[model samples]
Target: MSSSCPTNPSSSTTRPHTYNRKQKSLGLLCTKLGVERRRIYDIVNVLESIGVLARKAKNQYTWKGYAAIPGALHELKEEALREKLEGSQGVNAKVWDDEDDDETLSNSGSQNDKSIPNSDAPKSHKNDNRREKSLALLTQNFVKLFICSNMELISLDDAAKLLLGDAHSSSIMRTKVRRLYDIANVLSSMNLIEKTHTADTRKPAFRWLGLNENQSSNVINSRKRAFGTDISNIDFKRNKVGVFVNGEFSQKPMKQKELEHVSGLGQVDKSNLKHCTKQSSRSYQFGPFAPASVHKVGPSENNSVKQVHDWDSLATVHRPHYQNEALKELFSHYMEAWKSWYSEVAEKKPLHIL
Candidate 1:
């Protein structure tokens, strides 16, 4: 017997019901939970101590199969009976710490002439705490934007546009997108992020999940409460019609005489009149039509908008490819000597409101 992965009983009651006795590798679970592999093994040991049965599936320990335990509705409602799913392993300190380690370092740095240390350098525990706090702020902002946008999930491009302020690095941009994907995967595993498919069918978009029955019910109820309070109606005939009579189509409009000849109007005028429909609007003469094109700026146009660039330039000052010719040559020499990975961070685009 192995340990049971934490289960949220409240989740069982409120989350959308699914009866999948599926098996997933412990490595995959660790990645999703943002924990070390060894930590997962320790968790398995702890779960075995309790009655929660787990067993090795392939190379991983998955929840053991069992029939649904008989319990009354009152037992299900008892908050005490609900197991703590998220609290399993007694709070993973490392996962929490890894999330922070950035900001702690920044606050400790002095305004000395010395260049700021690269992210690769080792930092104290205090630095790690600061980093976690910074990550938290970023995550909170991202979540808030997602909720208020009234958009069902934004695309990767749109998401990049939102949180990452304009700072350019093709490699850095990819890294940020990858990091966002990792965070999203964690939320999705917890059933907090809902996945949506793109029109291409290959790419997926993630939205803040309305997880389970309770959440869905709350959303529906909220909409119902607003119903009939401020109803809007449209005048279909005038506003909805899309016919372009005076534009390009009118330049070569079929003359009445041409229609008359086609229908033998001289012999019977009513024959040509019968061809038109009751919904037809009167025709008018017009000239050639050409639609105007909307111009869009690409990522490189860093023309200082509102804030003159909303990014931490301090971070990019140390990059190998920065504008200084001497630093570029110096860094290039070192980089060429040893084939090590030097990842460039991508510049984020400005937030798109629409």
Candidate 2:
């Protein structure tokens, strides 16, 4: 028997349900499972990919229940088979060579692809750069690995090797692993699969939750809890009728005076009222409709409107007395000398160099 196989199948089957659907911290899971944090992460990633776990927040996951696994696996299998058929039929005629895959992987991950629009053109070119590197697309491929393969529990190293092939460099493999880690974290949060140790070697692996025998029962109970009696007693109603005049769809209009009155009432006065009020009194300041005299600034006080100062005039104003007379004279003499030298250079004929 392979070391990856679970020694105790019963314990493995019941382990996921023990956590329930509550949000659990990664540390808590690690402590409970008696596994290393890194190993727990490996397990969480693969489980999350299949929709059994969902991430609530940082280092926290909500179990979505294992009942969703069967349906998800079925859908994934169908998709895989469909893709395989399409490939055989030459539907995807573009042969993805090693160079192309490397280039696509390199360009697609890590950052947002934004294109600057040409102002001269009426329509801007659509950015096709994002489609190749989309997280959603990466997630789909990651899930496809489980659906297409016969292996029940796959290690991250094995998965990376299989997906990228042996031709890819170590750095590329590392990049692929990092992307897989992200995908796995998201999938674990969804509760599709869960981390587990293999039976023989104690190697950390992801066990698919869909294969559980108790899934149907759990799903039925969950549905019952969610819907209660509401689903069985649904009441359907007819469409509401609108007022129609003659052949045209029209309703009675309000009088102009009435409309104006309503509009006036609807308009809220946003301007703040200024008034001297005692702090102790509750009714010291009047509301928005306060008298004009209460809002007026006092005659002795400066006007609220700002006075614009002439900064440019101040900047241009010369203060010759503030400068050193000797330095100023020397600068002026140098400026005259440079001006004369430049003028003489401009007057001279162009000299040809051999």
Candidate 3:
């Protein structure tokens, strides 16, 4: 991402599959990965791009797992070399620009710069018309920039320029960088790449970490997550929430992303959402049959009774003081729930709290 970045060389760690390969449906993956179906495409594109997943049918993909990445990177490096070779021979081919956005960075990784050729950028001008801006293609090409060269770090701006080929329109470059940010986020989560800064200018850049096979267990584990990460979002409405993990559909994706920030109380914990009174309310009108226990009051009288039960004032008065933040938030929510219920019930019947 332009705001932060990715980093460092990790030798293609050769390892075994983390788990048994199980074919998963889109809905099932949505449930497992803690993301909506629409957002699933980003994961699909990144995994399919890197050879970790293969589409067996519509809305389903076979999990190739990490075993496929080495082969995929090898193929990409070989393909880039082939393209570079063809370009040298005056044959037209798609090329990755490999040029740095800053000269200081250009000088730092000079050897890597020489290993890749930007001379072919001009020649690949024709491909823009024929080429579609596929995330998978951009992903492969972006990976090619790292795998094909020994460049220690490259910024998203630089990466976008390289992948953009001859299309340097401001709009196109902006779109390319935005997509690159999403790819970087997912890849970083997988540990395939890391975010860092350039050594020279200290500009934000990415270093390819590749596959880390050196862990005690070299397989992908889905159960673990970083602390303080919340994926649940309260704003976006999901159509069909099919299945859930830990008794709820996770608010955020399995992989935490900086782009999707699900911060604050209500976003992660929606259980107390019933306490939110955002809807407009007309004054309650009591019918003649309104229970003998409940006195029939006019709209104005009801309004006066409702005003008497000020939720915030009442809640604040009863709210407990706590030194611990967590306990404080818990009590705060409890007060809010009590307040909402008290206000709603005060309209129909008086409550006597012991």
Candidate 4:
């Protein structure tokens, strides 16, 4: 069976005074669900973006449910339209298609601070930087891209470029893709988006279904995931416990793809994809999530990956039965993450396993 809603959490780190961290929804949910704090943040940010939840107060959020989605999308579409109109009128609209997203997000994040007269300068600056790159804000901006535009399919690389604007460094671009991968997952569970591929390039991309389209099925089976649990969301990351097949729980938690679903980016460039076969090893600028290895470069051989000739089959075979883009990406990570990881590991490694 499939379900169509997601849950969220609300957090505020820069409270004026000390607050109870454990009592917050983020912490409480983590305890109840046995999930890491960061995972809670990911779900919260994406759910809040799609109107499944709303920030009520510090560390609190209201359950808006799936019913709120249509209204929320209407508001987003209208806001996007207004930005377009402003752009046409030379009003310097900052929300969409700005040349540099760093400036745009920084400016957007600081609008509230301008009303304060005596806030600490350093704290405010730090808050601005955090908010500019926040997952919540990025999710909203990504939604605006689909809500306002006519394009049905969008690749994550293109999304990163659009959302990052002119401030796209390899590191920033990689982070953006990882964030987008997460947002796609939460939305995919709700059937708001579907994973597809571009016809011309045959690279994986996502298609918009929003809330209007209807797909109801009891079908719950995939090579990588099981429909047996009847849960709306699937956990791709191994639990905190070690994976011990025969011995003690001594194996590290799924020492697998930290960077998932990157083959579609072709090492951040479609034109350079063919080079993957030629380059056995390349220098990498490791991201925050990169594992430390004495030899940062290695051969391109996928030790245990299934031999798939193309992205289309790879995308289709290893993923869940549903159209959840996140699962599809995760399935390919174990297979292709090896091939692309060393090649694009530095600049384009997605932050976490989705």
Candidate 5:
């Protein structure tokens, strides 16, 4: 006996519509169902798979009986339901419930059959798929959290504990770890998250460098390919009085006087930061390249020409004030870049699992 029952459309012609039918748009469907728009679309796809509703030329789904067309399970609803009893009595309500489903199936055959896919599958399979999708969402949220926090170096254990709901549940913890690694691998492959050894013995670490830098050294350090290294070992040496010029500043060198004016470096170290030297009165001489450029002129003119040191090539001025300026600039760049990098990363889809 088929589980489908035909709706007698002609007989119901005079009957008034019963259920409150409110037209629902896609956005409203998502909100009401508590599912993402994409998930709603997927559900629609699955419904189409079983043929519960017909899709019109405009690609919209109409209610099951709107077309009055018989589908695969049309005869199921007409099947007679049987009463069955077990040990304690002549008839059991529980047992009747099971038989009633069969009765319903037979009576509303096509409609029930079309809707059957949602209930016919094993519970475990459904749960497994649901958990998988949930894990993906968790990972995405974690990544977003990390970026928003602007944390440069973060541990996997911390990330896992923060994301996995039951901190004590080993199974949940393990699942989160696996998902994190999966996401990490995907980001690494895309060159978004760089994986490198931070230390000689420790495991590799991931770095987010989608940010700008100040002394340029900050940017270089951010790009440091070696991960898991001791933060103490990276020789963060400053060769000169680093300037934290704005990104809009020209790349060209500033004269000694100009450097003092902009950097507010006192006259004591001004000579060391010269941009160029004057030879005799007409030509400019650049030192650091003194020996090479001095050869381009006669002995007299070469001797007369003075080195005009530029800001870039200024002699090492590790004055406490300048060092402080450089450090402040470096720190600012680090924080800004980190925040920007993290935000950009979080906005993307989770890499680890689909």
Candidate 6:
């Protein structure tokens, strides 16, 4: 006898709803489920997309309950079918037009030239609109995988492979997963899907709350309870160790008295220190640990004596010596001879050469 059970049993069957009607945070859910913050976001997006959870604010969500799921599924199915029909028609028309254009271009050279400019013009315009792959479009496609597939959940690795092809290197797949993480975060904020371990292998996977009946239990009944705590009011900086006091953690600003106490503990007497008169000397101080002086100087008295002696020797050497009248007349005659030679050469040169 052969068993008629589904190949992949619903994990949600074993995992019962533990959350109540109270508004819960994605962080709290992550902690409770022992899952990463990023995984929690993926789960939340799938849940929110199906009306299982409603977003109230940033990082906050309100339980909308599972009662709305049937209606949500019906709407999704209708939309999906409509899109499928429109896509098929659009694809067929596009193919026909492309084939007709190809035939016309191949048959007539003149028509090809005219069509070339028009085709090239659209391509240029398309190039202008081309942009880097958008995270939003990636997210929509990611969610569509769940919406279109029969699988209730999908692993990030599998999703990455599906979105980015198996031919991509490990680095490329890692990059795609990172981008998916960001998209998952936005979807989580919207409360569509949720992260959970698979039933068979206990590996992480994102369960689609929009379509699966077992996943419907993940939704909590809405209760008119007090408003959820404002996360902005929570002081994360106050407790580095994350110690909770009473019900919440708080960080109070330093009081004036505390500031005064701290300031007084390290107080010093500024007046007791000697003020530096020179800017260059300010960087160093005349202290016990001061380095030995590198410069050597002679005694002032010795310096003065050496200076006097040097000056006297220079004066003696430079003193004027009396010359005989005949020697002076010989020097003057040689100087006149040089001046006459220089004037002759200068005057004989051409005006252009000069």
Overall lDDT per candidate, in order of appearance:
0.26, 0.31, 0.39, 0.40, 0.27, 0.31
TM-scores for the candidates: 0.27, 0.33, 0.44, 0.48, 0.25, 0.30
Model 5 alpha-carbon drift over 4 Å, by segment = 1-135, 197-201, 211-354
lDDT of 5: 0.27
Question: In terms of TM-score, how similar is model 2 to the real structure?
Answer: 0.33
Minimum summed lDDT over a 10-residue window in model 6 is located at 276-285
Q: What does candidate 2's lDDT look like per residue over 1-354, in tens digits?
A: 112222222232223433221213334433433334554444443443333333334433333223233333444444445545434343222222134432122212112111122331333112222322334344545555554544556556545555544355788678767766655543432333344545544455554332322333222112211110011111111111111111111111211122222111111111110000000000111111111111221120211110011111112112222122212222222212222222222211110000
The deviation in Å at residue 321 for candidate 5 is 55
Order of all candidates by lDDT, from best down to worst? 4, 3, 6, 2, 5, 1
Ranking by TM-score: 4, 3, 2, 6, 1, 5
Better of 2 and 5 by lDDT: 2
Q: What's the lDDT for residue 25 in model 1?
A: 30
- In terms of lDDT, the poorest run of 10 residues in model 1 is 285-294
**Which scores better on TM-score, 3 or 4?**
4
Report the lDDT tens digits of candidate 6 across residue range 1-354: 012222222232222333211113333333433334553444444444443343334433333323333333333343434444444343221211111222111111112111222453445433222211334234544664565545556667666665543255788778778777665533432234555546555556665543222333321222211011111123222111111111122232311122222111221111111110000000011111100110101111121111111111111111112122211122122212222222222321111100
Query: lDDT score, residue 2, model 5?
Result: 16
Clashes of 2: 19
The parts of candidate 2 lying over 4 Å away from their true place are 1-75, 88-130, 211-354
What does the lDDT come to for candidate 4? 0.40
Residue 86 in candidate 3, Cα distance off native in Å: 1.5
What's model 1's lDDT at 341? 8
